[model samples]
Target chain A: MTADMTTDMIADPSGTRSPGEVLSWSRATLEPALRGAVDTLPGSLRHLVGYHFGWWDERGGPTGSAAGSGKAIRPALVFLASRAVGGDPLAAMPAAVAVELVHNFSLVHDDVMDGDHTRRHRRTVWSVFGVGPAILAGDALVTLAMDVLDGHPATSVLAAAVQDLLSGQSADLEFEDRNDVVLPECVRMAQQKTGALLGCSCAIGASFAGAEPVRVEHLRGFGEQLGLAFQVVDDLLGIWGDPAVTGKPVFSDLENRKKSLPVVAALTSGTPAGELLAERYATADEDLPGLAALIDEAGGRAWAHQQADALVEAALCDLRLADPAPGPAAELTGIADLVTHRDS
Target chain B: MTADMTTDMIADPSGTRSPGEVLSWSRATLEPALRGAVDTLPGSLRHLVGYHFGWWDERGGPTGSAAGSGKAIRPALVFLASRAVGGDPLAAMPAAVAVELVHNFSLVHDDVMDGDHTRRHRRTVWSVFGVGPAILAGDALVTLAMDVLDGHPATSVLAAAVQDLLSGQSADLEFEDRNDVVLPECVRMAQQKTGALLGCSCAIGASFAGAEPVRVEHLRGFGEQLGLAFQVVDDLLGIWGDPAVTGKPVFSDLENRKKSLPVVAALTSGTPAGELLAERYATADEDLPGLAALIDEAGGRAWAHQQADALVEAALCDLRLADPAPGPAAELTGIADLVTHRDS
Candidate 1:
């Protein structure tokens, strides 16, 4: 094994590792199996997948860097949720790998739909590999995700989440051409698009751990609420995040006029600034910074921050209801906190 | 129930039915459950899927005709394979529905990749719905296919076929940019692209029928060879079938410079006509009829016809080896004949 792969296997003697350490350890545990699954892909698709995962460059050469890999938050959720229910995190490795694959599959396709040029400080898969190959890459990942489950009872769980995810994306695309998107509809879209998979990650993890129906339900509730919080925070990042940290153009979502949570909230809010922002949005104005200021002035930013905090608190209540083991509970709480508070 | 649906449920008084009768009966047996699964999709995706299935127009109104729906050949294969193994075809309805969903999923995505605007005498899903929604429609169909399996043993069977299908498509996309693709590689691509799912259809159906592994394997062999024959005939139709019958523009494959089996066979034939055809294919010349004539002159057409005949013979041998019941066996034979002999 390479040094990079082995180093993360050496767990800290300390019991209370930070969320970052937890994520690193989870990724280390998940990599071998994930790579093995991807390696089974056809050569043409394997190259694009590896490049998307930051294991290699576009030419199939090693990049010698892991900076392009995302934080792998979903896999971490899977591992921690399994451990929280008093199961060996190792037992949930397939669930972890499957959720991560599903997450990346959505990312690859989302980039194609949004016409985004960059991700994780590198060219997006569609931008680097062309649209057709990128679509195939996404298709391969989703198929592999189902295959990895290998008829485990959790297959239904994952498949339902996938359907919800696709439905959410369909709504997102439909909203692009409309001006009357309400907050409830927009929130439902976010839940389906982002929350469904996250909820599936926790539920599947707990199910793999042989948890009872009640515990799995509670864990799913926790993950679903946290997922909404994550999406709310993501909208915040899309508008005002530092470009260097987020690895996207400043005001990227606004540039595409995405009907994101914050923007929709502001559009539906009955304020003068809200009206003004809507007008500018309809006119194809290039004043993105000006529009961002208007959304903030219209109370969209504050409403989003409030929603994230409330959702996170609700998620913690569900976590407690699950009666999780103490150590993993603490780690899950820390991860949840990090999700809402992260700058990117 | 609607008259259209109830009409085909009536059994024939005679002991025999034509291949067309078998297909229509399969479609009738499969529609309610198939529509049930699709109706579960979120509204936005459901509309697009229904339109693509020829149940509705783009505005979501009834089409009042089934002309645009392609033959449910895969489902027919599934149902016949089940009955051939002495199981009730109705008992294998889920398998039949799942395979047909997978078939249409591939078609929806293939249209996007090939930029095909027309299918079955109508506009394709992508052409009518736009690219992003069409992609989601394809995603929904494939996900629904697995969901319809619902943790059956056939889940892995379907998943494996999906991977091979994606790999075949990847190879096809790669071939579009290269001139050195050989005959073996091209045939492998066709087998992966077309044969894998058809084989899976038969195997899954036999499995659902509680057939032994040996019988299932033989049935799969039958379907795979038949699938190759089906593809070879499809390539032939792409070149020479009348547009009024094929529902494609004249010389569509040659117009796109598709490296189909016959074209690749001609390119590697080592004949003077083959050399001339290769030279012509290298340019931007629009003499599609001339290209078609050259491919025929190079013996590509004859070779493909011979191969299709050989494959059908091999397929029949496998069918007989499975020890199928006489009635379903005859129907299967008729379907295979129709596949290899149809103009469109």
Candidate 2:
């Protein structure tokens, strides 16, 4: 949470400095272009977007720019992937900005669809402006993203990614209503919703640098697998991470009855614990801790963690195909470590 | 309403074939690509889109493809303008499909934002599939539009138009909250919301054909002016046209308390009828026909019709600059006539 990256704000138990610190370095360079592009939004949308970024308080009061949690992660992929491929990070700015804008547009509309009110401890755009304005603002951001991708062949990559993102989101929403969500279905949904954009970011950076198509596809594969791995690890933290460190209650995802990877895994495992957990879910919110334990006992947690590790390994293989520089490649390895191993 | 394009369905008062007939001609070529693009939407979205396009009823009952009113007009502009500029209309099919996709994207989101339940005499996507899916489908369509526009420099033009479209929609939602709306402000909003995509369609057709910048600009101006003129005429009809022709309860726009062009003009005129109408708007929806009369008495209808005439005149001047082929040029003139003079 600290502006100064040297502070051990994001640390591993073994005490090595996590490469997650790369986010702040990229954020500093990416901030001006992001703000300038957001400023171009018409009328009150400038304020709504400002409010979204936490640069301003909900009532149109300026709060200066606050880093949106995990927002910098995708853009970090765009920048570091550029550098890893021997491309200038600054030249990849438009791709980076467009990726971030695309991410925010999804978030804005997602909140409206889910009726979510707050994120990063602030009111959502739909919560502040009416639904209509927020929807239009999201539309404007998509327009801006397309505009930024202009003159670059990477626009096709971004568009395909966006379609994939929406497809995943649609499936996720559909999954919420059915108790029949299987593990592979959940994983594919996660990849579609989250991995596609990450994949696009990786490919678009190389694309803007005029990299060979084969190398670009390799980077895309690496980022996509990395994204799926990251989501699995995040779902893990939502359940079992220490509240004192993570600041979220234990079994957070379970309490909300989210059909996340682990939960879906346990529910469809055909084990005694899985059956009990599924039955309990249909009832009230009682015994959330027991449900969490059932998922763990049913091997859901271990299964998810193992999948994350395997995906990360596969992602590393793809990263090798891209033939990235050793130094930046090492940073990517650190990022993978940071994603899969962060205790907090 | 009928399959026969030769029907006098959208007849001008004088016994002549309406240029709305041109939509059928353009639809012949554009429909296949348009359906193929929409089919790329994942899973249930294909069905939802099918419903939105009137290919299915609410229960997924197959309906033969029905013409979506006004949906074809923008694509028609794209195809006709391409031919008008001496480009082969067949070569402009991608631009035509892209424009229609963009238009439908707006329509889907606009219905969700506006909270309307029905469009095209059928259930809306949100009402049937749910809001989340509808919103996601709209996002998917926008992505599809960008994908279709790929490898074309007209992509930038489409992006800019989408931005302008969003800007207009935002201003419109904002204007609904404020009591003061001026004539010029309303006109600009109309231009932004309606004119932008229309202008985009016109220019994209030429851009696809590798038209010079000056010709593209001229065609864009013509389309934009024509859009403004169309809105003016439509607004005039909302106030004074016979309900039997327009298919609405008398004063439907006024009854819904919409801040439409004529209503805004009459509200801001500073005349006695304007003051009376303004006071009436603050109260209940009683006497909507009377409110419509006040708009007429305040010179709102006459002024709107006059502005429409002027804009069409100005539009024709720009159309001449494009130096369109005579046959296609006549079609454009007929379209202008049909839009301005339609009773329905």
Second chain alone, TM-score for each candidate: 0.96, 0.90
lDDT (0-100) at residue A120 of candidate 1? 93
In candidate 1 chain A, where is summed lDDT lowest over 10 consecutive residues? Answer: A5-14
lDDT of 1 by residue, A83-198 (tens): 88988788888899999998999999899989999999999999988888999899889988987888798988998899899999999999999999999999999999989998
| lDDT per residue as tens, model 2, A160-242 | 88888888889878887888888888999999988899889999988877788898899999999999998898788878876
Which residue window of length 10 is worst by lDDT in model 2 chain A? A7-16
CA lDDT of A81 in candidate 1? 87
Q: Label model 1 with its docking quality class.
A: medium
TM-scores for all predictions? 0.96, 0.90
The models' CA-based lDDT, in order, is 0.89, 0.80
**B111-152, model 1: which lDDT tens digit per residue?**
988999988888999999899999999888888888788788
